[model samples]
Target: MESKMVIRQSIGFPRLVKWPRRVGYAAALWSLIFGALGLYWVLGGDGFPFGENDPRGQMMGSYLANLSVHVGGTMIALTGFLGIFAALAMVRKWNQKRLYFLLLFYAWVMCAILLFIIPDSRILQNVAYLFMFYFDLIDWIVIHQVFCMIGGVLWGTTALAYYRISRDACGNCGRAGEGASIISASKWGKVFTYCAVLTALPYGIVRFAWAIGIPLGTENIAIIGDFSGEAILGGLCFGGAILTLALIQKWGEVFPRWCLFIAGKRIPIWLVVIPATSVSVIIFLTGLKVSPQVVMMIINGEITMKNWGEMVPTLSWLPWGLSLGIATIAYYLRRRSRCKHCGKF
Candidate 1:
């Protein structure tokens, strides 16, 4: 009877790592290695990290003395360096959940901000220019995206792990509210959801066009057919938009009977939050990375309406990224404040 009671009250979250401290040590090593590379990028040859033969290296010459690359490199190096401490804290078994969360979140935000600020031509005009030349300059853009994307996955999954390890410390310390006093649905939440859906429309439409064989660029139709890979990502964006709608709907608060044994149970806060937040991080990193370059091209009169039409879906990424972040954060706060037991945060 006591065990049944405990099960009813417990959140049922699973442990991601059998040894958190060991994994933390591994993460620390990984972050340190990246930090070292970032250091090289700043202090290495001709201020471009790679040689003049690199695409990022080539782009450096267009600017006034590679100033932007230096600043971006320094910023990345700093974040990567600081990240080691966060991972190390976990290794030391720090009881401060907020401290760990803050450190990891800061790393994610700094990397995302730097990605948007750097203005790499590889993400020029809002679409990731992946297959342009294949190899020579590929590392420039590939590293930038891979770094940010990896950080997003790392920090997000780390957060979920923390929640499972220490639910109370990680913001699940909440209980039932007064009978007449309940948290109301937020209007801002609805607004952000609508915004995400709206912004996502352009991208979905473009992908649908491509899938149906509409050629938007100089790439041959069959060559474009090879771009079926992009269609999957676009589908994910649309899926995210649909899921965002749930944040503002009735289904988000309660489970339907479809959920087998857990039917009609109050939805687990972590379940919804972890996935939504993870997707938001990914979209923000991807979409915002192209914003500075897009704006610069427009300001310099290099992008006309005709050219913009070629990548119409990408234009929506900026707004979509921002709205997704806002919506996810709002959802998290609302859920955390209403955990079924222990009304403390």
Candidate 2:
């Protein structure tokens, strides 16, 4: 058995060696393509996506909304060039401490801008709308946002691969001869799980109240106009809350008997991780765009404590997203099996 395991690992090791390089090359290509597009825009291309040219206009309130086409385009092109260099260096494993940390910092900053700062509430809303068959609602702007998010994911992947390789860790599993990862510890898993659940509740509860016309914290009856949307959103919130509990539950690993055909089977990891992570990112980005505006409104007396229901749930989104993301990571750490590529367990 030991010999067989060794042979399997030897076969897999070559692929592990190649994985980071492949990802790094991909990131470079992405940077090249996107950067060229930015250059085109800078050279008087007509379709600049942000500022007054944005279809949503001031409604988006994007951080890029104030920048001129030339300025934004120049910045984009510069980042793209930087990204190419970074990607190549990472692929080459240029591991000098200062240079490595600088590249890592650049990668994360790009990830944050693309993933969280550039995108706004529209992306989240349009995604939900897409599920509801509101096809007409999705436009070029949403598609652009999606592309930015994809870039963010790519940058994030590149960062992880670079970090693991530079640190001489297992490229596939990131295990450096560890007994267990701190993030995967059972206690931390439970803590983050409960935090996720708790943060989600206030929003769900408030939405439910509005759905039922209870006006839980508001005196305005007209706010209840068309309770259907509220009900659906409330249901989603509660459903999400319930799903969050699975991070700490036994049934998260094994399907319960209540599940018909899949009963007694171990759950697929990606099935849980992908959707949860996607939703968490969207929620966090939307909250990043919204929470500040809501706070400003409150301070300016544009929103009042009497209408707390309207704004408090919105504020919860930031924490809800953060907690959910951590909880999902914890769950993944606890549940992941031996790395197929590097034979890390």
Weakest 10 consecutive residues, lDDT, candidate 1? 173-182
lDDT of 2 by residue, 1-345 (tens): 533543453463466456666888888888887798789999998777788787574565477777788888999899998899888887766747899999999888888889987778888787766656677867766777788898898888889988988888877678778537744467787887788788878877887888777888787888674577777777777888899999888888788999999898677776789999999999888888888888888889978768878776788889889989988988888777666556676
- State the lDDT of candidate 1 residue by residue for 283-323, as single tens digits: 56555555556667779887775455344456687778778
- Model 1 ranges off by over 4 Å: 1-31, 35-185, 213-234, 253-266, 299-302, 305-307, 337-345
Q: Which stretches of candidate 2 lie over 4 Å from their true place?
A: 1-18, 55-58, 179-184, 219-222
Kindly give the number of clashing pairs for every candidate.
3, 0
Clashing pairs in 2: none
What are the Cα lDDT values of the candidates?
0.56, 0.80
Which pairs clash in the backbone of model 1? 174-342, 174-343, 175-343
